[model samples]
Target: MDGSDDKRLDDTLIALRRILRATELYERELAQAAGLTPAKLRVLQILSGRKEGNATPTAMANQMGVRQATVTALVDQLENRGMVRRERSSTDRRQTHVVIAPAGVEALRSAPSALQQHFVANYQKLEAWEQQMILSVLNRVALMLNAADIEAAPVLTIGDIRQDRGRG
Candidate 1:
């Protein structure tokens, strides 16, 4: 690539990494302030918005890209705290499903919103075309990264995988 092309590529990569880190850090702090580990909060968030039977252990493991055993431990902790409960799947009888408890819903309901309100307020004030251009660039960057094939393992963010087993 030419010098300008190389510079652009490096700048794009750096900016994307920084944005991801910032988002993860924000999520981690918010979850902690809500009295939850990041992983548990994500699990609660996932369960809260789902259909009744959808938050199975297998589904959660796949969504989080973790092993089944890890999900089991997470569920165990949530269950102990009365945030989640496991039920036998009616159709299979052998499969277990997780549902959020009322306490879980109330706990999460009291937490602050995820993104900073000021960011949204400011972003909305930008011209429509400017907003569209920003989104277009971000979409293209995401697509290009997704299409590349490499041997490197996917980087786990605080939300993607916890650091202190549950600290996010």
Candidate 2:
């Protein structure tokens, strides 16, 4: 590759690093501020938006594009910390819902807006052409890295973000 090609590659590497750094810093900030992992916070956000302030783990898993087992693990953490509790449904005794506790609501109020939420807010302000361009470029990059087929949710925490053990 020529000098200009090398420069472009370096620039692309820098941009990818910046995106990763931003996500890392955001996760740490959120953990320290609200003592919740991105996954847990996401679960709470989903529940808090519900009319009943609760949902089955399967429903949350579907919404998050993850497995029910993954959602169950997150719910288990929240329930252990008194942030949520499980209750059998009144109408469907066979169905159990994970209800956000008072503490969970308070955590949401205390935490910063999620990293992806901020990204979505800004992305929406871009022109249609700009949005399409970004999508095209990002898709190309993912394919270049052989990541196009990887499963991912809308959250932007990290590739494998660890739990925070409920600090707040």
Q: Give the best candidate by TM-score.
A: 2
Question: What local lDDT does model 1 show for residue 18?
Answer: 84
**Native-to-model Cα distance after best TM-score fit, residue 131 in candidate 1, in Å:** 13
The CA-based lDDT of model 1 is what? 0.69
Writing each residue's lDDT as its tens digit, candidate 1 over 22-127 gives: 7677666666666566566667877987876348988887776677776787788778889889998889999999999987887688655655344567779999
Which stretches of model 1 miss by more than 4 angstroms?
1-17, 115-156, 159-168
In angstroms, how far off is 155's CA in candidate 2? Answer: 0.8
RMSD of each: 6.0, 1.9
Residue pairs in collision within model 2: none
What is candidate 2's lDDT per residue for 1-168, written digit by digit as tens? 999999999999999999999988988899888988888899999999999788999999999998788888888888988999999999999999999999999999999989989889999999999999999999999999999988776778775423444443
Best by lDDT: 2
* lDDT of prediction 2: 0.88
Worst 10 residues of 1 by lDDT: 148-157
As for candidate 1, its clashing pairs are none
